[model samples]
Target: MSEQDNATLIEVKGLYKLFGSEANKHMHLVHEGLSKDEILAKTGHTLGLKDINLKINRGEISVIMGLSGSGKSTLIRHFNRLIDPTEGNILVDGTDVMTLDQNQLEQFRRHKMSMVFQRFGLLPHRTVLDNAAYGLTVQGLSKKEANERAVEWLETVGLGGYEKQYPSQLSGGQQQRVGLARALATNAEILLMDEAFSALDPLIRSEMQDQLIELQEKLHKTIIFITHDLDEALHLGNRIAILKDGELVQDDKPEEILLNPATDYVEAFVRDVNRARALTVETVMQPQICRITADSISDALKQMRKTDDDYGYHVTDDGYQGIVSQETLEEAVRDDNGDDALCEKVYEDIPIVAPDAVLEDILPETINADYPVPVVDEEGEIQGELSREAIADVLSPDQVPEEAAKASQPTAT
Candidate 1:
């Protein structure tokens, strides 16, 4: 798919799974929806997952998070058909994974998706080189090509020199690197990571997260990572889905979940987050924009100076428009014609941006760009000013207090 196609990559509809036999006392409870007591009374088996629905997008990272036995792992396992949904539709890239026959399901699992698990599943008997190449080898490539690809992935995963070593010779982190190499070698568009770093030490886990970020940047692959750690979810997920008892309680961008969790359970998960770092331009950009034509530079500048904002300004054929800035005003003033000295100046090109850009995030762009960047609508119309000072103010710890104190005191002429 092209980069612009933000279509759903994976979709799940009302997925459900239950475990029990006819003699299981919980059989009646299963009809009512199994509770702990009902399951214990009816049969020993527990309900692993309940109805769950989710969608994953193309080329984005979505994290699934929950405590142990919350059905997180069980839900992810259903993605590649490792566990089939008892009654639901799982559409992977538009194909119904649940509807796939055994042969088709096997082919889909082998080729369409790749997985990384908490335990590094490298072959004990095989050399690291062979273990890394196992996926390609199974795909019917020649030994030479598979090894070549394996070596390439080894280098990709930063383990270039350990190709011939056995699994026993590697550290836990190193073995996981081998597992990562094996997963990437498949070149699957969708990657499923099931607590891939949960087994590593804290420091090692952090390092692995860095590596994962780097890999995602380079490959732009769509990923679904499962973890119980809220901090890890915040650090790595573009969006997160919180599951409890096989149900998705919350699925949203990290900031949304942090700022407004759906439940106390989810709120507890995000209570300690550093919210400022997680926010983006998409959240803080001003909604109001003033349109400016080339001839109305002075007016635009005056508006900008009056508002003390630098966002949502534009230069259209009618006149200069957007978030006003002194710089924009000055540029517009420079375009003034002799006949309308106050209105004539016109700036041909104006920088434009979305309203959601946070202060610090947008300041450097405006400071370095040719003009005050115009906060624009999705269609590129001037919406507001993206001011450097606004960003600086937001980044400055004492800005609010200083501004308040100054405002409260009389100003010197």
Candidate 2:
């Protein structure tokens, strides 16, 4: 939904999983609207997943979330073929996972995918460096080369000096950092994180989430993260899939899910979420049509009159200069001053916000600003303007965009 390129990395099609001796015989019962309780009561089969179809884009974080028995953990295992589906196709980079031979599956897991578990799965006897290097060592790399790679990743995850320490010596957060270092040390393209931060305390969990986001900006690995927490899902997932009773109830971008919930369950999940934190300036920014160059006093006044606005943004070839007021232009004309003198009258102390900044952070600046806050990029080029009205529109539930409404609809498999 965030303008992803037409490249799908993982594709799960018509996936179903049933746990019982005679699972195949109860397929018809599942299709006939039988509940999970009824299915288990009658046939002694536990349905782990049903008709699960998803397309995970390359280098994006796809979070699968649900409650305890919602099948989120059961669903992620299918990605690495740790658990085989009763019926479905698991395609990774266009290769069918189910068709892989034992050796091929082993190769795939070793070379292509690296997993970070809820529990710190580091070897007890191994030092942090040795644990981090384990994956590379298993792949037949020399000790020197593997340790070098592991050290680099360990430093990246903020554990440079702790390489000599054992897993028992580290705190839960630090141990998870080691686990992350180990996964990153492998340099695998696909990262499978199952409740990776759920084991940490709230503060540590939040820190790890921030660390992962920062790392993802550079690594760009295709990540499949599992979580039962909706807030965590919304924060980390580029796309979120909600499961209920072993079935996919909804899948969409987080903003779409928040703005236009597809079902009552999703609505309840989003009801208390802080909308200001979820919505970015890009979602509510208006076009910067009222703009003028420093030399164009006449043009500035005319444009302000046309837009019925008192201020206009003054921009130079370098980037944003400041805001120009109609009163300043009028006085400059009355004094018959030159363009240089008029340019000096432009107010350069205007409030500004980055396009990616959330509304919660933008509120303080906009609330006290005399004019709409200018939304600029890294280059200081003005992209749009965020007015109070635009912010209100975004907060209004009925004013959600039609595109977002359509995006919230379930994908047809």
For model 1, residues 168-283, the per-residue Cα lDDT tens digits are 99999999999999989988889999999999999999999999999999998989999999878978998899998767899998868876789998878776654445555555
Provide TM-scores for the models. Answer: 0.73, 0.89
Model 2 lDDT tens row, 1-413: 33442578898999999999888988898888788999999999999999999999999999999889999999899999999998899999889999999999999999999999999898999899999999999989999999999999999999999989999999999999989988888888999999999999999999999999999999999999999988898889999999988999899998888888899998898788777778788877899877776466666666677776778887889788788778877776676653443364556466889998988776766755667788889998999998766666556455334443343356899
Looking at candidate 1, the ten consecutive residues that score lowest on lDDT are 337-346
| The candidate that achieves the highest lDDT relative to the unseen native structure | 2
Local lDDT at 183 for model 2: 89
